[model samples]
Target: MSPSQTLEDESHPSITAVNRRIQRLSLHLTPLPPFQPSPQLHMLECAKAANKLEVDKASLQCYMRGKNRELQEKVINFFESRPDLQTPVGIPMEEHRELCMRQIVALVRDAKIRPFRYVVDDPAKYFAITEAVGSIDVSLGIKVGVQFSLWGGSVLNLGTKKHRDKYFDGIDNVDYPGCFAMTELHHGSNVQGLQTTATFDPITDEFIIDTPNDGAIKWWIGNAAVHGKFATVFAKLILPTHDSKKVSDMGVHAFIVPIRHLKTHQTLPGIEIQDCGHKIGLNGVDNGALRFRSVRIPRDNLLNRFGDVSRDGKYTSSLPTINKRFAAMLGELVGGRVGLAYSSVGFLKISVTIAVRYSLLRQQFGPPQQPEVSILDYQSQQHKLMPMLASTYAFHFAAQYLVEKYSEMKKTHDEQLVADVHALSAGLKSYITSYTAKSLSTCREACGGHGYAAVNRFGSLRNDHDIFQTFEGDNTVLLQQVAADLLKQYKDKFQGGTLSVTWNYLRESMNTYLSQPNPITARWESTDHLRDPKFQLDAFRYRTSRLLQSVAARLRKHSKTLGSFGAWNRCLNHLLTLAESHIESVILARFIEAVQNCPDASSQAALKLVCDLYALDRIWNDIGTYRNVDYVAPNKAKAIHKLTEYLCFQVRNIAGELIDAFDIPESITRAPIAMQSEAYSQYTHHVGFQ
Candidate 1:
């Protein structure tokens, strides 16, 4: 549901029905939590669908607002018929993406999920949700897991019926969500305090899953309440006849427990669920809580990689340490974080689309003869939006680049390099989302009060996408991960202030820079960067490296005097800043590299502007970095004000052209608040009526 629908419009019975349908919606938002970021399309669908269906609030359960029985059926049937993709193979990711675009477009056209957007709430059962959120789960979970697994995850071939059939039986064809409920209300980061226990009964040959206390309740599980058919519940396995009635070194096990009955829409005995109350954003999702009272399962329910129980209900495992087993379980969630980063790129594209379109059309004062120029003509607007535009472009390329690298690493099983890639991606993901939260809001505000007007898309986008900042592994946590990686590099070079590797890197860097940035000539093959490629390359690399080194050094110094936890917390801010430095450096590398690769001159010119916009944007933010590198003297940053003005002028000329690349359908994009074309057309129509 969206704020646009006039809840006050109850004169008609239909409008009254619509308002009630929305009142039932309950969920939450992010940005302040340890979740993850997501795609732009999710936000766009909400805005467009709210306009299309004419609803109230940002409710994901649009089925609640169906006007007629037929419309409701259309909405429900659309999802019911969709296929589930268990393993993503043979299908091209691009094809999968196109399918999502077409599916949503068709969903809107057919009035399926008529209110729309709410359909994105569940990721397990349907293909689109699977493609979007499930894909992230895999991307992020796999990425993080790969890292965590190396530190500890069990080797289980995933997404295959072979392994799934063993553990995920009986619940087949249920066509609903499954959850991994590991977080207990009493213990978030601490795994030991989880009070849920599974006691073995040798006579019955069953393991009972029960939440012993209120503190043991599973909280914050996505799609848990209404959507989930089964859950992989984590509980301590209590073995009898043997010793301590208390916790053991190797008792926790992941069980495939069925919580909902098939014939009736009632909860099975011993299972309790509650929908989480309203949230700050992500209102479409049915985040929930669950409690188990004497819930029992067969011996096979335990995922036996680390620990298992026999048919006689005897506990048995060769697992070395419970710590390793616990690490393995937690390792499985790393892909979620990676996917959050990737999704952040997708959302960035939406911001760019809106900002660029508005920039092109929302003009004023720049051309007095024109009376009103597009807001993009103003340097302030460009400063606020264009760099972000460049950032989205940067992220788009970076995402593709990393995906390709990830795929390769997976193929080659190059563990060492993959770790570096994971670190880089983690840093990149953390950095991008942190900035994206700010950038998206800035772009939203650049639209003036129209930005706040829900009709224009920003407010809802802001509300729904709130989790990007701190989700999928907290931004701070991931930044520390990056800091840890950087500190390793710093320590490796401990004696290397001695300079052998430094000169080797500096020489290779020079060679690549010189080769990439050939002389800036009018020759057809000679690109602008070719003119003085080294200077441009050095501008990004030297400054970023300098900043990263400085922060890492500061952080490294405290380790000697302070306790580990204290130092980690003390250097938290430094880690975050260094994450930004990596982002700046990576984006710079991506932008300069991509611009040079474009074959067409016009394409090259447009791309070059994006690159410069990115560089200048960062330079403006940390002028000190540039100052330190001598890329610009202290006063030169002020002089570079001319560049922003000039770029704004240039960007204005190209804004319309660039935004067209997003390819948002005119059917969806026809509103004036978006492009102003709709309002203009309305004015024309009113004049005709007069």
Candidate 2:
């Protein structure tokens, strides 16, 4: 049945069940997570809870199972309400995140407080923020806010109110920091290629912005095609066809253009608009194109913060390099990567929360008479869920680092830092969203076929997150950029410092691995390390760091002899693999930190288990750093199996709170598979909503 139909079928029953639940909470339905001790711990804690509460083991087990069912049902109900908002993939994940985020924010505006209950009841806020429905990715817009407020918004605008400025008044519609026009169809990733000419018509003392060809039209601009009424358009400054040569009129420039005639949504005369066509994802944004044909604007409309044209039509700029001017314009895109990186975190949240919760409630194996075993009990399930959990934690750590870098760069206003952050962000952005897309799919699969049901949420998240891998820049392409940056830094190491020492050490390690007796890119096995936390951590740390250095070295060495394009291609070939390994290595490092920092005994044990899983799981990826080595072949199968078992064990311990992070309230997730138990009283019921 459609989700709408499904919800209708269960709505009445759910209301009754909810009412019973409220009454039971007044009595003994189920205790809260933090207070219940074994509330989220499935087996061991539950066994203890039975002893402490003097309750029957069977009854407590039944209660625990039923409450989990209720929570899962809450999640299902959340999806049923937002039917039009199917999670799309490709570039769509970014928009979906944005769309869900905004709606969630809108819900908070009037709430007495930003209640957790609201996110479950109306999740559009979370979902909206994913960047669907619109072509413009709010990720950049968000950074714009971040830079502006440092309070909330990144360099992107935090839509405070409508602005009816001289050139554009309609920009006031959307909330927050905003974006300007820089990307033209011809310009693409190369902004210096822009051909639009914005010339000062001396008599009128107004700038005439014109697109000379279809190729010169601005395309793929997030806010430009819609929502954004005011755009800082880039055009070449040209002296009249009079006394000066092209050089005399030379230099690309930026101007503020009022593209739309606000009230009517009509393009100003000489401005033509068209949708960039249907896209793979990020549909909520009207990713459209804009063209100008002698569009007239007042002389002051030129964005002259860096350069200016006088009323008499004379041109002047404080900076000398036209190349630098071009760089400045493209430089604005720096925040794009930062916002995208943050966005990946939110997408990971929605995905893991759904997968973990569903994993707990949908138990399939057990005796015919006994309660079914939670799917999480199986080893394979842990292999799927735990690594992803570790991944979410890993990226969160990296994202925090990126955010801090962004903060420092914001304060320092260092141009080189901006570019560096930009490159790193681009690389990190690609790594994260792509990995999230991969991991979310894995999460979907780990839950068995039930993961495909729309009501289950995985299929939705998987599809929705599909676009994240390719949107901002194609994942492989972005990674190639990262690889290039790595090579550049490698070359710059002659200046030597502590980091130089590390890099040199890394170079030697890669050389050692490549010099292995047999290095044929064999798969890795972690059998011996499966039970040994230190071994697993050390092995992963050593191998991953080695692989990254090797990949970076190959690109750098090739550049000196080959032409630039060939050099880039040489690096590009290894980039995707390098990015994957880099992300995994980074994740492992953070996982180790979590293990070391865990204050509680159980928590430390739990983190150690996660570390083992993370390390052992990617064994082969680690060993690939070693050249084709036949020596490690005999133990491969054994290691894979042991790692698999470890994964299962870890899942058994932490499946409950994993589900809680989905933030789905007990009041919601009511589909059939998500049902609670039948053990409850007339005063208190158990069973998923269905």
Candidate 3:
């Protein structure tokens, strides 16, 4: 061998050594798993399976529509048949407002739907029409709500017979378009703090409505900008004392103040109306601000069911305290919150239907050489949509229950039931609207780039639904009211006060869940246990009861140093959680009851499945809360997560029937992506590509 070859051989490692090193490295490197082929999911087959799912769509529809299925269909049919009522895209705000007003006019004159007539004679029918209108066009819904629910409701609920007799016909017919001028520039949730004053003028026998400062100007008043001829204006009622000449403030009262001339449609002499201009959404509302220099209405215009001004200008109210009278007046208007909650569910149904329908058609990556899988088949997409679908079902039942309770309260006038309804409405409204708003954004994202298109309806739906969280009642403030009411009930429970029907669970919950959860039950991970209605309800009750006890204790501990309001401020987040927990429990209970009460076995079974998904998904999302308190073992939490996914899969299999049960007409959805067939083709046509 040459010396150079010998050197090279020595410099390099021997072949045996290299082999040994390679063997050692191979030991550390993990081999990729053997490829298992993905099962091909055919879009047509999946769609067929969804349609074949044994769910009683008609029964489910009837259950969801509650009191007025035929009436709702009648109203929806009227709007669907009219091309003029169809929502147009990309219109200027002014044109949209005009369209909305025209749609309302059509409903009254063409359709012969008298909204105010139903206020007393048939409130359920009235609400049914409201829901139907809202499902078609949210802007038109708000206009109708402003004219009928708020303005006309004020007269019906707060006014005496004479006021109703004079205004109901014109208001209902849109001859006297009216605004509900309660919200001010600086004050909204605090209705008691409204700064507009209505001072009684004994000589003129009229009440002078004045906006004292810019802050007192009525803001966000629907119909005020162009159409409102009058307003149900809320202002502090000041009356001269009989003994002294000084005036006394008698809290807030509603007055029917004329805002515009009936003949010329001009602003009244003392009223200044300015368009609120553009908004993030609901531009069809024609929201405007109003300022009164000295707008005057006769004393008889006062909605005097609870408080009144006499001919001599003396203020009298059956309730002695000003606060009590104000409470009573506001209580009469809880229907707005109920209507919002009920209508928000409709928006959620529409959004979920759009997203789910599109998901069923849109295909993406799958097994090679096979047809691409429907996006709805993917686990991630199911996660985004199924829980929301389940929640829509849950809220439907809860909102229906709310309507029933409100209707009963109106008939019976039970004071306890009234308070119960108030608190319940606040909680449901806050929870449902907030959930719908958030879910709309999720729906938008779930549809990928197609969802981003304005023509898809997600953008407008979300934008308009977003304000549902603010108007009626600010969600945060409404939740605080719920917390306050819960605390009151918590104290009353200790004093041996009988709990109302809605809250009777509190007594049992305190007894059963105040202690640590049973080890066997906490660690139970079986599918049957996790899906059990009893087990699910027990878990919800435990969470709410524990939260109530803990929050009360925390507040007591902090109040010594922080004072009452300060203590509450410190525990604000905890209080919100507590309120939400309670509301969720209420919703779950209502859903369970609905399933049991369902007449059709197939529909009941379907509803049961949806209910299970809602309950388990809720618990899974808050598993940390359960884990922190040892209410659920780690293994059980895993089980819940697994069952939740499984339920999502099951629901996905039947998504078609579930959404179809909503029976929303395609014309109302107005999204090319939501088309029953050839969705992509319709989408292309919508975008002007064809």
Instruction: Please give the RMSD to the true structure for each candidate, in Å.
Output: 18.7, 16.6, 9.7
Candidate 2 C-alpha lDDT tens digits along 34-129 = 645443346544543342222133332232222233433333444445554333333353464456445333323422123222112322222222
Off by over 4 Å in 2: 1-180, 200-205, 223-227, 235-245, 248-253, 276-282, 304-332, 365-372, 414-420, 446-450, 495-562, 594-601, 627-641, 661-690
Off by over 4 Å in 1: 1-163, 166-174, 186-205, 235-241, 245-247, 251-253, 305-332, 366-370, 409-413, 492-540, 543-557, 628-632, 635-641, 667-671, 675-679, 682-690
Estimate the lDDT of model 3. 0.89
Give TM-scores for every candidate, taking all chains together and pairing residue i with residue i. Answer: 0.68, 0.67, 0.92
Sorted by TM-score (best first), the order is: 3, 1, 2
Lowest summed lDDT window (length 10), candidate 2: 151-160
The residue pairs that clash in candidate 3, if any, are none
lDDT string, candidate 1, 351-418, tens digits: 66766776676656744565776677565776677667667777766765555555455456464545
TM-score of structure candidate 2: 0.67
Which candidate achieves the best lDDT against the true structure?
3
Worst 10 residues of 1 by lDDT: 146-155
Q: lDDT of all predictions, in order shown? A: 0.54, 0.53, 0.89
Tell me the lDDT of candidate 2.
0.53
RMSD of 1: 18.7
Model with the higher TM-score, candidate 1 or 2: 1
